[model samples]
Target: MTVRPPQNLSSLSPNAAVDVLAAEIRMEKAISLERTGEAAAKAVAILNALPLDDPERPRLLAETAEAVWGYFIQRELMGQSSHGAVIRDLAIPREVLVRLGVRRMP
Candidate 1:
């Protein structure tokens, strides 16, 4: 990951800036991955706790859908395009999945 030094290389070593940039990228990716995992966990918890016939179920389902949607988008950003493993691991409901990426379902 060697890069040409910038013109204003006042104090940085040849690779210092590049190294810092790489580390920052890695940290950001790690944070993104962690957030996606947390999002999936939250959606699972909400789905597991919802009552089948409760009046609030619709609202909760929409919330769950949004959370999973964010998780899927984060996964895709990290180059994980397949949802099969995560879907099985989380046991995500098809009802929620159908409404993913849609904030309001008519």
Candidate 2:
């Protein structure tokens, strides 16, 4: 197989290349945050709807915790470290909050 030369960015000035790359990065970040938020929401909804006595309730709680944790980490990566507003806005259950980072006891 013939090695192909790198795609040309010489047509773009340094600033222009930087700006284009930045825009792409921003779009990627927005998409990531949106997807994470959606997953967290879905997990929370399933957990909330599960009956407390249901055997699946614990599993749902764990799933919700993982989703919420992922969302939080994504926000933190975006430099939004304050979670009080997010926690309040999402109405995350205290049970799930407590389970964040906790492993199930075998």
Candidate 3:
């Protein structure tokens, strides 16, 4: 069975979203290591070191990353290339974008 990531629902600040994106990168790297039977201790350690106030943040990152990486795996499974792979698949959806919450200049 393929694991899927949950869609982003709650809106957050830009900083929070960046943090989430960073963590997701880390999670994808870790998952790649795991699938190859390589120890992801370093990646896990790094993620654990992050000063994230939201405990759910890490899981969210992992799930999101896995979902993203799954696309690549699917492409390779179909014998595709860099261009053939839908890199745009990684593009963040507009709905998932959080407002910067800054006052606009006139």
Clashes of each: 0, 0, 0
- In order, candidate lDDTs are 0.83, 0.84, 0.44
- What pairs collide in candidate 1? none
Q: Tally clashing residue pairs in candidate 1.
A: 0
Stretches > 4 Å off in candidate 1: 1-11
Clashing residue pairs found in predicted model 3: none
- Tell me the tens digit of each residue's lDDT in model 3 across 8-64: 723766577768878987777666644532222233334445566777654644634
Q: TM-score order of candidates, best first?
A: 2, 1, 3
Scored by Cα lDDT, where does model 1 land?
A: 0.83
**Candidate 2: segments with Cα more than 4 A from true spot:** 1-8, 103-106
Cα error, residue 55 of model 2, in Å, equals: 0.7
Q: Which parts of model 3 have CA positions greater than 4 angstroms off?
A: 1-54, 83-85, 92-106
Instruction: Quantify how close model 2 is to the true structure by its C-alpha RMSD in Å.
Output: 3.9
Better of 1 and 3 by TM-score: 1
The best candidate by lDDT is 2
Q: How far out, in Å, is residue 61 in model 2?
A: 0.7
